[model samples]
Target: MEAIATQDRITSKAERLRILEQTLIGAGDKGVRPSEIARRLGVRRQTVYRDLRALSNAHVPLWNPGRGRWAVLQDQYVGTVRLTIHEAVALFFAARLLVRMADEFNPHAVSALEKLSLRFPEPVRTQARQAARQMEGSPRNREFVQALESLTLGWIERRKVRVLYRSAEGRAAHPYVLHPYFLEPIAPGLAAYVLGYEETYFRSIVTLKIERMTGARLLDERFEEPANFDPAAVLQNAWGIMGSPDPVTVRLRFTPDVTRRVKESHWHPSQHIEDTPDGGCILTLRVGHTLELVPWIRSWGRSCEVLEPAPLREQLGAEYRAAAALYHAG
Candidate 1:
């Protein structure tokens, strides 16, 4: 990539004098247009006129207008500037993402940026700072950030590390690392989840809860993997990031009063909806795994009915009865 032209590094007057002399000496190049120079160089029209006049003063035959056309008398281009608005925005975001992700690893650079004012123009600097501030606490998730940072580094280094993690059912274990592919932002905004292969399961990209991670490193040696390890394909179809091979086809019914509530939100991608004859709605959700969705399913109370997946229906019924038994035992 060619360097972007900026006033950041301006040439000496002596170098400018040499270029002007060369323009005067060269016959092919003539008449640097003020407007073209200003547009291409990213500066005011007056700045271009000033440079042209500076050249002309030194015996260079540079002209602003001649025969309704203007061209640069100089054969050499100092540089070029061609940053569109879209590119500028993208660069701004990329920088902020880097700063947020790399703050602890390179604290010196981050501190330097914060202490001294940005070298860019005031408006651009202000906008960038505002964008950074917007990301600072938008998630309100500072509790797991440090742990995430360490895990992220371990993933990049391809080393085994131990983590005291609480499972979905709240079981604790020291999960050893096999390999880390990537992290993903699961929710539209705020939340992030680390999806990586675990040594315990050998190549399964287990979905671990970032919030439940206890960043305690273990004394165990680094783990290894063979060349022929294959990751489970069932993860792609898993609902809510729970990868389970034994999936179920689930169906739900919404009463007339709660029909609008059921249709308003998208629970899953493959959800099917049908309008009922009694002005109600039938919501069918096919979950590849129904383990984590138990609480969510039961929250609907009498409004939702489990119409398929005999096992899930049985599980929910047992759970409901067990809860009722809590009061009976009391």
Candidate 2:
């Protein structure tokens, strides 16, 4: 009986260590407190501390961020990849772009940059590390991170997720069960959105901003993406991330002063340019909606004119008049 009890203790210790490691990894940058770890493992705080020490001695990159919280340095645990000099430089550039795009602190991005920097040489390595540090300085939005994680899990596993979402209009957050199909990053990359099927209320595919999700939880049930659903095709007519079922033809004339500037870049795949006799140009394209195009057209100021879509032209005219009124007021 004594030998059997000893064997049981050994088995329990082994199992506890395995569970402990998983908990630390899942904790990410937030880490877990020793007390929380103890509670989870049904052990004493001292025992938890001892286990953490044992794991550290075994070469796990465990990090402690005050208040007795412990976490795993995930970048250190992942496998290594060898990259050529040109590839490393390209990766470094991509990492910098990500840093510039993010508006909030994202630990995973920081970790990725740190890991990539380790493989780079000299000045490039230093630059990558600097970019990671800059990203670390951004404000931490814990709720946003949690929502993103839940949605990511659902999307990868084809599981349904319940999220409390609020729209840009500042409406009250409402719950919905969603079948996440794709995650898309808006151009210039300041924000990310998920396009999914709303199973509970809308019963339609909707695009939701990740930052607007107040809460999210993965459901037990799974789903399969629609056979005919193609994200790229769906968004092909989109001016930005939002797409419309019915596309409209848009025509814009750029003054000669800015026609050369516009012709320098291919704005859209559906665009066709026609040079006018007056040295100006008319660009035509079919887009889902003109809502997103409004801002871009406004950016060109007087150099641009909306020739087709009378409603859009009138809308911009009213906006311009309102702005003029503000400036012209005594």
Q: What's the CA RMSD for each of the models?
A: 14.6, 11.9
**Runs of candidate 2 exceeding 4 Å displacement:** 1-80
lDDT of 1 by residue, 174-288 (tens): 5555354556544322245666667665556566766667663432354444455443353545566665566677787778998998889988776899999998888876677
TM-score against native, each model:
0.49, 0.73
The prediction achieving the highest lDDT against the true structure is 2
Which pairs clash in the backbone of model 1? 31-71, 32-71, 32-72
lDDT of 1 at 89: 56
Q: Roughly what TM-score does model 2 have, to 2 decimal places?
A: 0.73
Best by TM-score: 2
lDDT of 2 by residue, 1-330 (tens): 999999999999978988998899988988999999899888999999999998888677899866779999885674235799999998988887888888988888898899789899999999899999999999999988888888888988899999898888967999999999999877543898999999888999999899888778989999989999999998999878878779999999999999999999999888999999999999998999888899899999999999989999999899999999999995
